[model samples]
Target: MPKIKDKAIIIGVDAVLPALLAQGVSPHFITSIDPQKLTYEKIADSADQIKDVSLIAAPYVTPEVHKIFPASNIFWTFSTKSIESWINSMLEGKILTSGASTCAHLNLTAAIMMGCSPIIYIGQDLAFPEYRDHAAGVVLSDPDQIKKELGVTNQNTVWLDGVSGGKVPSTRGFLSMRNHLEHIMASNPGPHYINATEGGAHIAGTEVLPLQEVIDRYCSETIEFPSRLHTALQDSNLSNTKKLLSGLNKALNDTKSLSKTVNKYDKLIHSILHYIRSENNNGAARSVSDLPILLQNKISNAESLEKKMDNRKHLYIWQILGEGTMEDVKKSECSLHEITILAKQPENFMLSFTKNLERLLSLNKARKNILAMFQHRLLHIINFHRKEKIILKKIEQKKNMEQNLFELAQFYFETGNLVLAQPVLEKLLALNPDSAEVLFYSGAIAARQSKFEESEGYFQKAQEADTAMSKRVLEFRRGLGGIYFDLAGIQEDKIYSNLSRKMLFKGIRYCSNHPKIKQEIIYLAESDLTRIKSALESGTINDVETILTVWHKGLEENKNLAPCITDDQIAGFHRHYGELLLKKGDLDGALKSMQAALKFTPDNPDLYATAAELFFAMQDFTNGITHLNKAVELDRSYAILWENMGDHLLQTGEINDAIAAYEQGFIAIPENINLLKKIGDCYLENGQLEAAREAYKIVKEKYELAQPPRT
Candidate 1:
């Protein structure tokens, strides 16, 4: 990486910043995309090394990222549909690309957009090559590692093409990410991408060359680019600066005015709600007609204000606080036409809409504050500096208002009013996108709504952001695990099972310091594994995929949990697979299952007996007798095995052999009446009248002796 800094324009993600900084390779631009504090903390921890580097952060990044870095060097990445991108397209400056979700994907997008030739990918090892997540200098915490390792069980862990040609362990996330990068490479075939990690998972679309070889082949000459890069940046960026400055100035004022109006609407909605439900009905005896008319007028005013916030100036707040009144109206009604029946709706919808308005205003205020921060950094670099002093003075800012909105949101969230709290948190996220408290609540809300993956991401970010909330976060995680656990118990849904097991796995990991909690969570997880295994064995759940999935998960989970799962238990799961296949009448599948089971326990008589059963189901009487003979040899006293061998022989017309097998069965169990009857049947079939008569007479006497008396 250091070798290519001088030869090529180096760009990377937030995760690589520490590695880049440690090696003294100042990236031209280090971009951030995840709304994770750990993502921002990596940048914060490398503050000293990042002075000369520009930061191109997405709008979803935390405000702390915006604080330490200057706005002049901090370019924001926006969606192509965004007004900022539209303005950039019209202006003479750097136009950023909206890559696929990951930072490395974004780096590729940027590299492709810049017309860079032979773009090389380094530090993109999407696998645990050495049983480690990343190379040196990347500080991945324990909790997140537990979470990532959730699905990568011993049974299901993916083995992909290794950089040095052997297979390596990887998770689904890394595989998906690699797929995305490969797709980008495949779609845009112009620039050649080189994967020079030389270890970890191999990428399909990249040239697998070592770093030194890449340098020798393409970077033999040291090209001077720093000056040209800075020159090109300065040449065509002045026009966009003024337009942005003017928009910021106007946006600051708009938020203050917008906030007061939303607050007013909040009070009115409560008043109207109270009146609508009141027995006296505002003491006016008013019909429904008058109220709907009043509501329509209020709705129009609120819609007008919301529409005003939906423009270019308020893009951050508008985009962040999505699902405005229109979404609310739709959710409140069954159809578009029923949106007109707003008056007939419950107060919850009204409160939700008003909450949306209030939080939108809160987001507007947050935007106001953020714009001031932007103006503080950008004011010095602008042509509008002559008007900057007055403009900065007129940036009507009250910091506590944002906090008050957060408090309001917290109250609603805590009281189980997610509809009201959701918009508020969305607003707060746009304000302080990575606050540990806000992120935790956001995750909690997502969990309640069954957005398990999104919830996990938020919880992980919250855990990474603040160590102070460690205990609370741990408790919350247990609660989340319990939710999945309960759902898994009641419904055999694969989604719930996967989620529960993963969270329980994380619980076992994160609560490692808390021995009691760790014990409890592991027991819960282990119990669930047993539960699924029991279900499979009982033939209650017969879906082949479900059976196999549970089988794999149980092995992995039990292995991870102090090797609680025994060889017998694992063999049982495998044997149950054969049992399920047998139950489904899949003779070939059941045979294959028994064959696999025998690999684990070749000496176990039960597996051979199972193979004999499958052979009987397959109607191969010869192999069936052979497998039963093997079972009897392994366990001479297994009466069922002896009896089964006699039955198979008799069915194949080997009467003498059948009679001898029945004698062996009677020897195995001396009080066996069934074997005596089988011997009589075999003797009779062989036309030996005296032997058949004697065997039948003995069988009749024993059968009569074993019979119960009539009541």
Candidate 2:
């Protein structure tokens, strides 16, 4: 018999006993210490190995008092905190022994005392997320090297990754201890260490094994194979087990059941694989779907072969035994005894089947590890996004209120309410002085009130103070030039008109120099040019090609400019693109563009109406009805959506739904004579004679009241 070389050392708090005994650790040499108590009685009851224990009456024990003779094979020294210190002192006399330390420093001292090599650490899970109390495993020591080695230590306490449930060490205490240990290891660097368990983090001189391998070898090895087999048989994923049982059940339930025949086994496999796919796909796991078709095809081919190999003896043999047979037995003697040798192929089938099952288990284990890593990382991303949203919302609310204040100031200025306007403008300027619209309005008010000095000062300040305006200064100059033109028309002054024209030309030149600012300025220039066309020649203005060039320039500024474009503007641009396509008689392109527009502007009534119109033009009545319904749902205030809804229903030959739509449209815009007439027509079309008469009577009375009374 081979010699059993396996041995172990135990070191921990009170919870280490279960792990020690399970690993077949001997009871005669184990020692435990109790620092919380003053006498040996407190610990002796808890120490499983001891028959009796005695406490030293004094603070320290001498070598003679400890009964340390040269012949002593095992020294079971019992002390609490001072054990490592005493061992270190004894090392000066060249005496070597194995013992555990109370802390990292003490652990180091004990190692030096023993001159130990290759420390195998276990049960050091101090930083584990939950209180483990103990690991259900043991650390084995080699008996041959027992005299040359020191005791193992449990030095795991603080953790770095808090999300993984690792404990955070106190900065003043464990961190300082950790730093000191690192310094010592850096300076000395001799004793090798390996972590036999993985719950704790790596300290200065240890490296951990692959965690699952450790769990399997240590934690799971205690579970008997029979117990694991029983659990596996019960698992839902093992469909072959279920199918085999079910077939047997059916065969027993009905003796003549078709499922019992060798031909039906292929059907059983096909049915089982289909069922497995359904169950696997119900979750998002694609790994389950990756089963090799060769296994399934083999089962099918075997079933066909079983059907062909027919004789009364063959049938009887198949009924008694399952799907395997030897070639010699099948070809030669049709004897039952020879058929037993054919059962060898079942082992090969079982091997392939078991391989798949093991693959699934391995995949499940990998999936669990991946999920753990994601759970830690995703928590931080979600937290950051939440904070960003909160900050953005606060900025938007403040911006909206400030915008409303600017609008109110404009209303007051336009109504010649100078006193009321002055205070509001001053307050707005304090908040956002660079707002050109506010400055322009203020300057216009000053000029109108004959405050020449104030107006000049305001215009000059507006020109200098406007940051956004400087980018498009020519546009503002053109606006001021238009104002000058209007003033000249009122006063009949050629000088003012010529000065305005000069200003317009100057503004256009300045804007042309900065092509980046040309798009918005050109759009404004187009509108202004139409207003001043009578005073200037047509060729004096830039062509449409020039304006398009400016548009292209603006587009080139940023390829990924979605966030920079305001949400409403993006929606409007898509809607315009769709409308342009529709106007060009490209209905398919229009529909696609409209759909893209709707993705951004789902609530825009005008875009929905245009999409409905395009769909209607394409003779897609069902789609037309759907978009019109969406349009009305988005904004009930739109009389046009209801009218469109009525028109589509009428076209589709649903008179009642049409009448209802027209009536709804009339209710919203009662002042519309055209809508009132349409409601009457809708009533007439629906064959509601009395309703149509009443609608006409209302319209006729309104028409008569609006006419002259002198007749």
Worst window of 10 by summed lDDT in candidate 2: 1-10
Tens digit of per-residue lDDT, candidate 1, span 1-711: 778788888887876777787897878878777764335445544653454577777766765455433322666666664544544644454665545678888788878877987888776777765445555665332222433464555454788888888887777778888998888888889998888886888888888888899889998777666677678778853565556666554544655555555455545545555445553433342233334666657656656755664556556644433333345434433443343354245543543444444444444444445434544544443433444333334433544656766776766665455545677788889989889999988887665443546766888888889977667777876664554334233343333333344434433332334443344444544454466566776666543344354455444444343343455555656666667667777789778777766766788987887787778667786886677767777887666766776888889998897888788778767698889988988888899889999999998898888899889
**TM-score of every candidate relative to the true structure:** 0.44, 0.20
lDDT tens per residue, model 2, 187-285: 556766556655554465655654444444444323233343346446724224334334334333333332234324444444544554555332322
**Pairs of colliding residues, candidate 1:** none
Best by lDDT: 1
Residue 205 in candidate 1, Cα distance off native in Å: 2.8
Candidate 1 lDDT trough over 10 residues, lowest sum: 487-496
Model 1: lDDT of residue 438:
92
User: Per-candidate RMSD vs. true structure?
Assistant: 17.3, 39.3
User: lDDT (0-100) at residue 452 of candidate 2?
Assistant: 37
**TM-score for candidate 1, residues paired by index:** 0.44
